[model samples]
Target: MLHAFRLAAVICAVLPCAALAHPHVFVDVSLTLRYDAQGRLAGIDEVWAYDELYSLLMLTEAGVEGTVDPGQMAALRGLDANWDPLNGGRLTVEPPDGPAVLAQPRHLSTQWQGNRMVTRRRHALSPPVAGDGPVFVRVYDPTYYVDFAMPSQVVIQGRAGCQASLQSGQTRGQDDAYAATLRAALAQELDRAGPDDVQVDIGAVGADSIAVSCGR
Candidate 1:
């Protein structure tokens, strides 16, 4: 059982970029899987998420246990619920090379452990094998059958980094189709950003870049 950690602040820290044109509006997260010298996956630890909100929601919240429609969505911004605003929702990312429609949801839960509130959630990994490329997640809304998507990659300019795609509004609104095109095209612009590199201003059209670091 992996535990989710909450930083000691509410601020969404952003990395600065010089340019801001045609940026991917979303966040990216790094799931660092460590193995022993014998190559037995020891544990999945310390996932650094880069504002890839939609991906996380699909994997963690929607619970990709069975059949998930190609379109689904859950609005969780400052949602009023049982726990804190942040923990009330979830995040999900698909395996590399998988279709844009298949996605696993991740939900966050806060537990009362002694005097403090602890946050924990199952990452619900898909294709647990290491080096298994990335997968596409279907961003959709349950109430409605519409789906949305962010281009697979949006290059950050300052340092030359790659970030995942996330979109708002579960429905295919006026501009959703265009956003989806970017999500799929981003993968071609550059390779995945290394595990620890941070991508900010995901919504910024430009002004982002990654030096290209490995996720682990």
Candidate 2:
């Protein structure tokens, strides 16, 4: 997974004029905020629908283009296991003092939706938190490698009178300029930065984020 990410980063950096202009892959995401019986925040349910091109590529690579065999199932599981949605700091949850980092996702699975791959997973907060106050959640690919957007309003569960809405991020020109700068910087740091060192600025790309308010 790290290798793949680095390779994509390099490709985008090296061909910023062409490749960076339009992302190679796209995903539509929806987040469902879950709460425990006590009304404390429990986890976030994520659903990602990948683009047809990327889905085909994944299926080809997995050698499960025609059937859903055992090997195909295992390959899908491998993809889920290798994917750390927040590893690139693509997600952020705001709390009182600071932001909350999410734990490894649970119940991650991928299925075919026509020609696309729809992935579902649950991400638990490191420490359970109260559903009160305004909780902000942002999901974006900070490196601008792949475009992610929410096609629908976020769903809130277990919290009464909770409402969520999406906020658009930077303007097209601003986002393009930012992507260009990031590509140039990444190109220079490709050799110096290890996989773990590669980071994305979630805030920079968090123009389209979900803001949740739990009314009393």
Q: For each candidate, how many residue pairs have backbone atoms clashing (under 3 Å)?
A: 64, 2
- lDDT (10s digit) by residue, model 1, range 102-203: 123333532222322223333334334232233223322211112223333432222212233433332223234333323333432345552332222122
Clashing pairs in 2: 168-207, 169-207
**Which RMSD does model 1 reach against the true structure?**
18.5
Instruction: Give the poorly placed runs of model 1, Cα more than 4 Å off.
Output: 1-90, 99-118, 132-216
Q: Tell me the deviation in Å of residue 173 in model 1.
A: 8.7
Among the numbered candidates, top lDDT falls to: 2
lDDT of 2 by residue, 1-216 (tens): 345445656676566533444455678887889988877777889887888887877777777868555446567655532264543225668866578868877766777767777788788987877778577787666545567776458778887888787777763643565555555456646565544443544334434778777766
Name the 10 consecutive residues with the lowest summed lDDT in model 1. 1-10
lDDT of 1 at 53: 44
